[model samples]
Target: MSKKILITDDALFMRVTLKNILVANGYEVVGEATNGQEAVDKYDAHQPDLVLMDITMPIMDGITATRTIKGKHPAANVVMCTAMGQKNMVIEAIQAGAKDFIVKPFQPERVLESIKKLIG
Candidate 1:
């Protein structure tokens, strides 16, 4: 069966782009969240195999959401997808239980590579 994925980003464009990429690559997109809070909530509803999360969002940031999800579901897989590439941010995301970090404006291959490593 195709793996289910949840995409979380405040930007509609980012969500759309990610959805397209995942769908075209034979993965299922189970949910989309406009913010971190929604991401956490949808995760419970969807029980996706992975979450593509963005940092620097209104409401709650991706790191916090990742941490929350990890706390609740220790086996949850989260990958940070953001424009922020700072060392500190990457470290924080890793500490928050993100399995991988991909800087925004990313190549489709890079995104798929990360997801594949986790769920494929």
Candidate 2:
């Protein structure tokens, strides 16, 4: 079976871009969240194999959500999405229990690579 994924980003365009890439690659996108709090809720609801989370979001930030999810579910797999100049936040995301990261203006290969490496 194809692995399930949850995509969380404040920008609708980003989420759509990620969904397009993932779906084309045969990864099943189970849910989408517009903010960190929603991401956490969706994570609990879906129990997806992986999460692609954006770092700077309203309501809550991705790093904090990753920390919350990992705190409750140590095995939860999270991959942070960061833009240029968000290097420090990416590091923070990793420390907070993200499995890996993908930089925005993402390459489809990188997204697939991280998900495959983490879950497959």
lDDT of each: 0.93, 0.94
Candidate 2 residues 34-114, lDDT tens each?
A: 999999999999999999999999999999999999988999999999998998898899999998999989999898889
For model 1, residues 25-106, the per-residue Cα lDDT tens digits are 9999999998999999999999999999998899999999999999999999999986854668878999999999888886
Off by over 4 Å in 1: none
The C-alpha stretches of model 2 lying farther than 4 A from their native spots are none
* Highest-lDDT candidate: 2
State model 2's lDDT: 0.94
lDDT of 2 at 75: 98
TM-scores, in order shown? 0.97, 0.98
**Which window of ten consecutive residues has the lowest lDDT sum in model 2?**
84-93
